[model samples]
Target chain A: MSGNFIVGQYIPGTSPLHKLDPRTKLIMVFAYTIGLFFLPTWLPVLLAGIPLGIAVYASRLPWRYLLLGLRPLWILLVITFLLHLLGGSSTAPPAPEDVWATLGPWTITGTGAATGFTTVLRLAWLFSAASLLTLTTSPMMVTHGLERLLGPLKRWRFPAHELAMMTSIALRFIPTLQEEMDKIIKAQAARGSSWRYGSWTRRAQALVALMVPLLLSALRRADDLAVAMEARGYQGGEGRTAHHPLQMTRIDRWLLIITALAGITIILWRWA
Target chain B: MNGMLTLRDVHFAYADGTPALQGVSLDIPRGGKTAIVGANGAGKSTLFLTLNGTLRPSQGEIKLDGRLMTYGRRDLEQWRRQVGLVFQDPDVQLFSASVEQDISFGPLNMGLTEDEVRRRVEEALIATGTEPLRNRPVHALSYGQKKRVSIAGVYAMQPDVMVLDEPLAWLDPAGQQEILALLAQLHRAGTTLVMAVHQMDVVADWADMVIVLQAGQVIYQGAPQGVLAQQERLLSVGLTPPWPVQVFHDLRLAGLPLEGEPPLTRAALTEQIVRAWPKK
Candidate 1:
């Protein structure tokens, strides 16, 4: 269960990507994902890799680690690719000349193969772009950026600051809870609950045993945390100001412009 | 009695009607090192909670610097700013993703300007010697580091009184010494220090005043030298006397003429034993 948990683990660095304001990264990633869906041709999908490649290089995070972040999604990625490659669900009959390969009564057409290849490429582009944001920016920064972005919605009675606080707290407690869950699992295993090699029903029972204690402890922790927070004078987000408020530097501004321009260019290029 | 914080016959019971504190009253001296000692479920934690206004007493009153505590929204906010509490579990106290952010929470919540909050956060990181881990994720910190960060979080508030619940529990000797040194530093800078601790040696060596709670009541509160001498009372409360005092009692029982108040610490005990070495 713990093996593939890689998304939120931040690797501290002084790289340019790490220094960009989280808002810029967030906006870029959002626009980039939208742009990925609009790419009209397989070549454009492959070309989308150029900016992602630059981002990976600029992040200075090990490319190997970034690829490893995709480990859990490989199965889905492959399934999507194969589904398109086989054209198994397509209703239209394949043209005779357009057939690329034939295997076991399924004819793989040029269009289906192209679609499959581009879809995989597009999926990789989107995943890496989002992971880059998580890798370079601390989760607190992400929350702060989100809160600032959502600040205008305060008029509609939106609880942006509270939601951001929740996200930050959740991110902060993830590892603590993970460590706790590990302890509970080990403890349950010691008490003759075969968590590792049990039959499906037994494993499910072991999970229930583990979850009950974990949940109770989490609640107790939350109670203690509230008292501690109150003692330190936290009433609510109202009237509270950030110590490290988000700042848009020249780099952040330039990156914002460039990303917007690139996104518009991609959409326009697809149409043109 | 004049104190930075004073409670008078304060009573508290849980929602389930478990009495955690019953008619407890005590004074925490300004700029003094105070240790609260108690057996498990003796209401040490509850008493600390009352001191900071985290838990309102059911029937009694608490005063901060002679001002009566009121649980109004603004009053409670002001009261919390004056008295900071650090929980026993650092994991529970640290809610921000990184050390710097966690330290900033208190100052930010105080409605300080961004610049002032930043300054306080920086000062706290330096005071706790956590500047190295400033940007490090909270979970990446070791247990001792998390404890320091938790202290830093409260310290950033610049409160007059710092109340800690079992600050020394679960720390190694070196970690305990580090925390004691930090507390001493804070005390020297004029912060009132109140901690509930289990180590009698620590209480004897570090605390100027000791308060012992038993069964939701204050059984003994006095200077360390005076409190350690009441071995039977502490024993009846399920607390062990400092080892030096215990050894002194055993020697006294064996007919040694060593006198002049049982030594509160090992060094004092060793000195007394050496001076009174048998001259036969």
Candidate 2:
């Protein structure tokens, strides 16, 4: 169970991708997600690897590590593939040339297999791209990037900084909260409140007993953190200055330009 | 006048009307080791929070450095930075995921430039011997390591008065000794070190001044040797008297020849025994 938690799994590295301004990486991920969905041809989607390869290489992370990071998503990917293969467009006949097999009302068409594989690939790409962002950028820098990207949204009266700050704090506390949850569960177990020793309903009822205290403690910790922050002179969202200003360097601009050009070419190639 | 923190008639009750502190008044002298000893829920934590402006008094005043500490934003910020309050749980006190970020949080809140914050973070990381764990995730750290990181977090702020609640609680013996040594370092550096501890014997050898709290009020405040010397008084407040105090009590009960006030420490008690031993 502990092997799968990845909310703040930022591996400490000094790769070029790690050095890129968070905003640049964030924008690239955003554009990549949109292109993954809108690109018209499956071949181009498969060929979108050139830019991803560059990013993977620049991050200096072994491809195996990136794939291993996707372990948790494999279940969802399989589900997506199975659902598409078994349950889509019941009335549509398989293209005669594309039909590979037919078993009991389920026609195994090449198109179905292709679509299923495409969906699975898209899901994998999305997950890996998102992981790359988190694996390289620290939570603090991610929040800074989000705040900078959404800075213009302030014109719409959006609480961009406040939102980003909440994300940042929540990101920071994810592991702490997870550990607290583990401790609370163990403590409850020690006190003989068996979560798994009883009937399903009884175990669920036991979980309620455990969850209440966990939530209460979490809230209490939040209050304590707020007080600590206030005491340390955290004023508010506005007029707060940064110690590590998120300024984009020339390299960041170059990366952004490369991302735009690569993204446009991929989408155009997909359409053609 | 510079470092004195005084609380006068500070009364506080929870929203449900359970009284936590009742007219507690005391003066926390500057630049020395002070311990607030009390039974559980005797307002030791409440007093620490109140001193640092985290809780508002029902009807009383807290004066820090001769200035009234109002609840205004600027005033509270100044008071908070000056009086770093370390909660009993390092888990709750630490909000940042990384040790370096957690330590930097306090200094960053002080509005220090990034370079200065980094320097302070480095200094604190070194001070607490957490340099090796500087980039490690907070959740990956052990309880003792987390405690050190938490202290380093506040140390980076360079608070004049560091209030640690149960500083020694949940620590192993070696961890306890390490923390005591760290506290000594803090004392030598002239940060007024204040801790709320449950053990009576602990404050005896460390705290220069000990304040005993009973049922939300100061029962006694003076030298540890004086307050901790009375075994009966210590037991009355849910504390076993210090070991030396108990030894002193047993020796006096045994009709052994002993002079002066009861010793509060092991070394003093040993000397008392050697001097008062049966004539050769």
Clashing pairs in 2: none
- Candidate 1 chain A weakest ten by summed lDDT: A1-10
- The first chain of model 2 has a TM-score of 0.91
For model 1, state the Cα shift of residue B273 in Å: 4.3
**Which regions of candidate 1 deviate over 4 angstroms?**
A1-8, A101-105, A262-272, B258-261, B267-280
Q: What TM-score results for chain B when candidate 1 is compared with the true chain B?
A: 0.97
**How large a fraction of the reference contact set does each model reproduce?**
0.92, 0.53
DockQ of candidate 2 relative to the true structure: 0.54
Q: For every model shown, what is its TM-score relative to the native structure? A: 0.92, 0.91
Question: Cα deviation of B13 in candidate 1 (Å)?
Answer: 0.9
lDDT (tens digit, per residue) of candidate 2 on B45-160: 88888988988989899999989988987787788889998878887777766789889887777777778888999999999999999878887899999899989999999999
* CAPRI accuracy category, model 2: medium
Which segments of candidate 2 are over 4 A away from where they belong?
A1-8, A82-101, A155-157, A188-194, A263-272, B1-3
Interface RMSD of 1: 1.2
DockQ of each: 0.74, 0.54
